[model samples]
Target: MSATSDAYRIEPVTPAVKDYLRLRQQAGLSPFSEEAATRGLAGSIFGVSLMQGAEIVGMGRIIGDGGCFYQVTDIAVLPEHQGRGLGKRIMSALADYMQAHLPATAYVSLIADVPANRLYQQFGFVETAPRSLGMAMKIGAPESL
Candidate 1:
């Protein structure tokens, strides 16, 4: 489909508890269902998904402590469906969710991956300077049922 003629249906994925787990793995991101099942988790997560008919094409989420900080996370579009600005749409949806619920003074952040970092930059995200840096510690690999 040509850029001028293609129109995609963008919405948060629903009734997709399983497909959600599969797509996240496809994007090389880990699933958090076991953690999510716990009744009172410490963080808040707002998820948005992009779909085409019955298939989930992309997804993103915001996770944080609900008060002082938030992070834009898990943004992904399948390999065959990328280059069409779907990731941007997902981010915008998550951004809108954030704007509606986040405190004015709350800190919003994310860790960008490779070329995708360029996309986040368009939304006024700047690299934190010498005082701060992105870091992480991986746990056990994802276990499937």
Candidate 2:
């Protein structure tokens, strides 16, 4: 479906903190506490919300320092809203933002999950595995060390 079909519209506004958290959870992403989510949402460089009337059904955001680095994160669509190409629409908006605002030398990255990686690849995201693997450690979580 088109990005702005009769059923939905993509708004170039960050989802409210409540909607952000709800979308993340409903879309099967890891949960974040309200305090953490509030701080994180405030730091979004750019974000979009997929709206169906008054309700937010999907979202995506880019976060990083304004110049050298950025990460496409929090891409999520409601389960009932999946299979409608909304994810591609969300990424298209993000790609447009990156092209228009980010520097040519800037490094944009995202940690794609499973089949969603295919969607990201269409946007020119390549696997960095074998050269530099992605790694992470949650704060306050038990460390391997």
Candidate 3:
């Protein structure tokens, strides 16, 4: 692992379709078929992946219309490398990108995975209950309810 506090680098995902699929699978963060990732890679309004040497140790993505709203999605960190605050690094990068580029009240958001919600809150995310409820429509299990 070439990742250190100093060497960690994050940039918007490139055409590294293979690396994205591999790490997302290893992290148990829902595997994307190679073609799906390649397609969605282009669909991303914004995204970031943490690279150390040739390995993608952390990743996150944003999906939405670029101008008015966005949803932060697909956040993952390799299991072997968890608990080092790498997810924070990923989120920080994403948040910075949002803050620098989005307009006032642009409404960036994400569906946090429990404890990960804490990390997001530090970066100005919050739970909105009465305002709205979060819902999902699993692609394969359309009638999952």
Candidate 4:
């Protein structure tokens, strides 16, 4: 498919639990339990779903305190739908939301996977290495302790 394909459109809506799990798995991201996903989604500040007809082929979300902090997370696209600029479409919608709703000093950040870091850069995200680093630990996982 071409970058400008009209076959897909980005919608400003949170993806349903099923679509959220499916897309994350299909896109090779970490798995989250249904219960965890459901609880997490309810806290979204803003989200976008890339749709084709009635199917969600991609999705992204922003979550955090309304005025002081925000995180860009869950950016995923179905493996079959990758490489068609759909990710860009999702990010564009998200960026627009952040620009419009987030306070001036609100800090926004994302822990991007290697190659996808390039994509995040296009939306004004910079690597905060040298001085600070991105880190994470899955709850209940041994490594987290």
Candidate 5:
């Protein structure tokens, strides 16, 4: 198959739950158990898949309370398919969805790893540091939650 970025078609569909998990694992993101993945994906507000002839080459998802909070997560493209601008394609779809669907008072956010964070800036995502920092804790861990 051609490795060109434009070769893939981005579709508005929930990817298979297993594909979602595998893509994340392949992309070096944290793993989610089968039950957790199933439940989490079931609650996604919207998702997009970059398809190469019925195969999910890439994917992204939006999750959160529909009205007030939304997060862009699980942005993953297969390693063999990386660097063809698929990440931008994924975020573009998500940004369009937010513009059309989100309430004006709603907050949209993402925790971008370095370098990937630069791509997100084009979509107007600003860092939330120096005023209020982003923080998190694993559930049930001894550390403060």
Candidate 6:
């Protein structure tokens, strides 16, 4: 949906556990087990979803220790809805939340994957390289269930 269209709306609500898993997968993100999602999402500080009627077509979340550290993550928009500015809508809501709720000195960060990093730049996110880099490792079994 277009940004000016009334057909789409962004809501300050955490997605259902199933929707979280599904949206991430559909958006080509890493897979999370039901157990992992249940535990992880329960700790979310804030989240928002883009809805076209009742369907959640996009999502973004801030998940981290609520005090000194916060990470902007879980950004995903369904493949069919990618180019209509939905990702920006999700980030706009997240940015608004951070601006309103976060402490002045809170450390906010995000790991932007390739092309998506460009969209993040519009929201004032800058790259931190030659000093610190984003890193990750998969836990548990080698194969996903």
Provide the overall lDDT of each model, using Cα atoms, as 2-decimal numbers.
Answer: 0.71, 0.93, 0.80, 0.91, 0.89, 0.89
Leading candidate by TM-score: 4
lDDT of 4 by residue, 47-120 (tens): 99999888898999999989898999999998778888888899999999999888999999998888999999
Worst ten in a row by lDDT for model 2: 1-10
Stretch of 10 with least lDDT, candidate 6: 1-10
Residue-level lDDT of model 1, residues 1-145, one tens digit each, is: 5421045556654325565667677777765674452321224367766877667777776777879988887687777777888888887887777778889998999998888889998887888868799977645643441
Candidate 6, 120: how far from true, in Å? 0.9
Predicted candidate 3 versus true structure: per-residue lDDT over 1-145, tens digit per residue? 4446566678777437887887778887766678788888888877788877676777888788878889988788888778778888888888888888888878887887788888989999899888997887768767853
Q: Over all chains combined, what TM-score does candidate 2 have?
A: 0.93
Candidate 5 residue spans exceeding 4 A from truth: 140-145
What tens digits encode model 5's per-residue C-alpha lDDT throughout 1-145? 4567767889998788789888889988887788888999899999999998879988999999999999999999988999888899999999999999999999999888899999999999999889978877676663643
Name the best candidate (by lDDT): 2
Candidates in order: C-alpha RMSD to true structure: 4.3, 2.9, 2.2, 2.0, 2.0, 2.5
Taking all chains together, each candidate's TM-score versus the true structure is 0.78, 0.93, 0.87, 0.94, 0.93, 0.92
Model 4 ranges with Cα > 4 A deviation: 1-4, 142-145
lDDT digits (tens) for residues 32-58 of candidate 2: 899999999999999999999888999
Rank the models by TM-score, top first. 4, 2, 5, 6, 3, 1
Clashes of each: 0, 0, 0, 0, 0, 0
TM-score of predicted structure 6 = 0.92
The weakest ten consecutive residues by lDDT in model 3 span 1-10
2 or 3, which is superior by lDDT? 2
